[model samples]
Target: MLKHFNAKSLFGMSFLVIFVLLSSGCDIIPGRHMRDQAKFEPLEASSLFGNERASQNLPENTVPRGEWYDIESNEALYTGMQDGEAVENIPIAVDRDVILRGQERFNIYCSPCHGRVGDGQGMIVQRGMKQPNSFHSEQVRSQPDGYYFNVMTNGFGVMYSYASRVNPEDRWAIVAYIRALQFSQNAPLDVLTEEDLEQIESVVE
Candidate 1:
């Protein structure tokens, strides 16, 4: 009887140990480690969904979190467009300081492709890159100020977008500087003041 009781007790202890070991690794129960949980990774294909793609498109009109938004609801301010057309002028006021800021940004960003004078003769072009159109060209000058902003934000032919590197405000500033560069190369003689002419004559002398 004593031997039979001992055997029975040993069997009970072995069963309890096995039960705990099995339950510890099982994730179905609450509070178990889920190190190998099922999930989809980027670009991973899946037949579970009808589209057979792991990624889904974001809903329209919903901006992602941590993104900048225009609080005043001025769509043109951010998009450089109004009523399906590029705006004709800068949305913000332009002053001497604004132009100066634009010059700094232009030299850093635009001068690499478009030369320091907007003449499409930067060092990159000298090294066998395609030459960009001069800002002083009649065709280019005819484009509205916002057109330049749009080009920078969305990129033109052979040019990558600067929208990530440059904010909308700075894009507008660069546009203003481009206009200044164009005027510097093509200013009308009638617009020259007497003092300006004197300086020109002095340089000529």
Candidate 2:
């Protein structure tokens, strides 16, 4: 004995309930479309950017945009070439600190192949790999400082370039350390007198 029931009201309530249930499951609406899209495309290229090409009609010898030459003279534009003239003719001094830093860096980066003594007898060489010439050799000793720097920067023979790995100052420091190694190996025994031996003994103590 219900008081009353309206047929139209009951029908409207059922429709509202169906609408709420369908809207609540919104994630299912795009399920088949997403799966189809993934099936069509399995991979995509990265959108990263790289260096731009030089502009057309530029002179062949002209430096590229955003780049600067170490020497302004056209004669010194090539690799390993430096202008003969220096604004100040002072020779850069090689200090102990710089040599120590160079030695540290060389041990980390070069010891694997060049050895701690620069004798081309590193671990790799012990394993039967090709050994580089000793830095103490006459040919290497006669080479100019710039020559070593250039070789390290651009590489020679089987060696790859280290321009990206080491900076200019560090390269110069390594050159100094190499000189030190050569000097120690070739030092005259006569130069070490009794006083020098006593000094060494005291330092050891």
Candidate 3:
């Protein structure tokens, strides 16, 4: 049988439980070592290191995985510029497979803001987010492939840099994919070969 407690008795029991929880705070929970760690903040003093510093440089030639060891080796590839200008060409070879890879990467990273077809009409844009410029625009099509790489690396107005999410090689692949989109949408009919025209004519028919 469930017995109902008097109001005074229940009030005392609730106050006791609240007191216990308040006193323990979060320490009563288990497996919070990372959050409860004793790590020091930046510039904090730590006698654990030889220099008694919180931060120390990695040993010589200690190349961290998924990081550029030396930007000097290829400044164009890393910084997306040559002589402080966007290069007219990609540093790496732009093969069919590479462009396909770029297409995949672009869909993952750029499509959220730029759309699948580079029209800047992605889902987020429909949801009241500021729309970006279409890649098919004359201004964008005239820009060099390195310009796209530079934008992805450094970010343009209202867009954040994807450098942390996308590596340099994939950034070029995305540029190639963007160029492919521009050509597919804005290529002149005069430039189409006889065979290419026939394929399009048959599809339309």
- Cα RMSDs, all models: 10.6, 11.8, 5.9
Ranking according to TM-score, highest score first: 3, 1, 2
Runs of candidate 2 with Cα error greater than 4 angstroms are: 1-80, 83-91, 189-194, 197-205
- Put down candidate 1 lDDT per residue, 1-205, tens digits, no spaces: 5767687788998999989878777765765558657888988898977999898777789766754867359878888889889999999988899999999999999898898999999999999889998999999999988899899989988899999888888999998889899999899999999999999999999
TM-score versus the correct structure, for each prediction: 0.67, 0.55, 0.74
- Candidate closer to the true structure by lDDT (higher is better), 1 or 2: 1
Steric clash pairs (candidate 3): none
Error of 3 at 169 (Å): 0.3
Model 1 lDDT, residue 139, Cα? 96
lDDT of 3 at 169: 92
Order of the predicted models by lDDT, top scorer first? 3, 1, 2
Per-residue lDDT of model 3, residues 66-90, tens digit only? 5654788888998889889999998
Cα lDDT, all candidates: 0.88, 0.70, 0.89
Considering summed lDDT, which 10 consecutive residues are worst modelled in model 1? 63-72
| Best-matching candidate per TM-score | 3
| Residue 139 lDDT (model 3) | 82
Work out how many backbone clashes candidate 3 has: 0
